[model samples]
Target: MLRAEWTKIRTLRSTVITLALVFVIAVGLGVVSLTSVRIAFERGLPLVREDFEPVTDAMVSVLYAQLALAAFGVLVICGEYGGGMIRTSLTAVPSRGRFYAAKIAVCASVALVLSYATVFATFLTAHWTLGKYGPSWSSDGAIRVVLGTPLYLTLLCLFALGVGTLLRHTALALTVVLSFVFVLSPLATVVPGLREVAHYLPDQAGSSIVKVGQQADPVIGPWAGLLVLAAWTAVSLIGGYLVLRGRDA
Candidate 1:
């Protein structure tokens, strides 16, 4: 059953297109950010020893880039429903539980692979660019930034997949994911105390794993933050599965 869903995912042009777009957007943003940093250095712009971690820029890039990838993740199942193909899928699988199980497996696997690849590429690109100046790749926490970022992105894709399954409506699912990560969380920054709270939000928590640069008021450490995000994803996925089973298809 999982194999069948995997085959379906691979055969879809949308999956290919979305993955390609994710790679392009992630790499593009990383390169652009690196370029800006280089240009600033060349111009001798006062390098304010600002607390804004360089790693956070990379996190932001991956964050926005994943919007499309997350949309694709959602579409992996919801698209079928939208196209009426889910009915055919249910007919073939007979049991909706097996059908959803296969879907969750395939979607999570594909999302992990594609997101990891793109984020890894982005990290390498950014790392190489940062190296040309100073900050040796061997510098403290550099290795963590290079490696952990992709894992963060992969988990985020999984989280988005869970939401997609739970909502089952493309626009609504995408909106909820994006709003929490980008809109609501950013808005949270406006409230003084809320900024700390925002750090526990899915994107914020997952972002801590992306780099070693410490925020003055970080809500938690790297592994802890990722775990928090993972807990949210797990809860959402389990809830989604229960809902999927109980709700009429």
Candidate 2:
């Protein structure tokens, strides 16, 4: 089942284009950020030393890349539904549980590989561009962000997939997922009383894993934040599976 799902995923043109965008957007934006830092140094712009975090700056491109990843996840399942292949897939598998599990696993595996590679490339590009200003592999918590960030992205793919499965419409699913992650999450952060609550939003909580130091140390601890995101992922997946079983498709 895994192999079959993987074969389908690999054959997807979006898989290639989306992964390419994930890499290019992340690395390109990271390089641009480093270039700005270079400009600042050259101009002696009096940037606050205490406010800077190389690791965070280096991975800044990931913020945008994550949107692409989520969209790719949405397309994975929604494409099948949109094109009416889902019925055929369901007929072939019989057990919706097995089908859903295989779909989730394939999407996650693909996201994990692409996200890790993109993040690593972004980090390396930043290191090269920033030279001594950037975090090295030996830097405290550098490895953690490098490793944990990809995990966050992988979970996000699953979350988006679950939402896509439940919604079963590409446009509707993309709108909900993107708004939930980018719009509502950030809105929750700045609205006084909701600030603390926003810390637990799926993306906000997961973002803690990528914070390495005082620059953006999260209210929640790294693993705990990831657990929060994982819990949300679980709820979405369970709900999606239940809906899938109940539906005619």
Candidate 3:
């Protein structure tokens, strides 16, 4: 079953396009953002800004880029439904749990690999470029950014998959996931009380796991933040499994 699904995913143009975009956008954003930061620093513009930090440039890039990744993750499942492939898939593998598990495994594996690649590229690019300025690659947060960035991104992809499975509609799932990642959390920055709660938001928590910078208003530490995000993923996936079993395929 796993092998079959793997072959199906490989043959699909959407899978290739989605993963390619993941690589391009993830690496491209990091490279561009770091280069711009370096240029600004060279021109005597201060590197430290309101929310930007030079030490975690790579981390920031991955965090932002994961939004794109999350969308791809959602599409991976929802696209099947959109194209009427779910029925065929279920027919081939009658045990819905097995099919879902296979997808989860494939998505998690691919996400980890791609996420690591993006993080590695970002680290190498930013480290070399930033060295020309002032902040050395050997700085305090450098290692964390290199190591934690991929883990954060991988979890986010899983989170999005869980949501996509539960929602089953690409458009609806995309709307919910985007609202959580972009609009809701950022919007929470304004409301004083919500700002604290917002840090516990799925994307917010995941971002904190990858954050190498010192935040002015950190609600939770890295591990705890990741736990929060993981909890969200876990609940959604479990709920999705139940829904898949209960529903008529």
Number of the top-ranking candidate, with lDDT as the measure: 2
Clashing pairs in 1: none
Q: Please list the C-alpha lDDT of all candidates, in the order they appear.
A: 0.74, 0.87, 0.77
Positional deviation of residue 82's Cα in model 2 after best superposition, in angstroms: 0.5
For residue 8, give model 2's deviation from the true position in Å: 1.6
Off by over 4 Å in 2: 46-50
Candidates 1 and 2: which is better by TM-score? 2
Candidate 3 overall Cα lDDT vs. reference? Answer: 0.77
User: Candidate 3, residues 1-249: lDDT per residue as tens digits?
Assistant: 778767766788877787777777766776777788778867878754766655565556667677778887887788888898889989998998888899888888888888888878766766776666434557666666567767778788888888898889988998998898779998997788787789888888867755665652366877787788889888888887888888876
The stretch of ten residues in a row with the least summed lDDT in candidate 2 is 210-219
Q: In model 3, which range of ten residues has the least summed lDDT?
A: 209-218
Per-residue CA lDDT of model 2 for 92-196, tens digit only, reads 999999999999988988899998999899888988898877778987788999999999999988998999989999999999989977799989988999999
Candidate 3 residue pairs in clash (backbone atoms < 3 Å): none
TM-score of each: 0.88, 0.95, 0.92
Best by TM-score: 2
CA error at residue 136 for candidate 1, angstroms = 4.9
Per-structure clash totals for the candidates: 0, 0, 0
Clashes of 3: 0
Candidate closer to the true structure by TM-score (higher is better), 2 or 3: 2
Cα lDDT of model 1 by residue, 132-245, tens digit: 653445655666765666667667777777887788887888899889877988998788879878888987787777655555335588888778888988887787778777
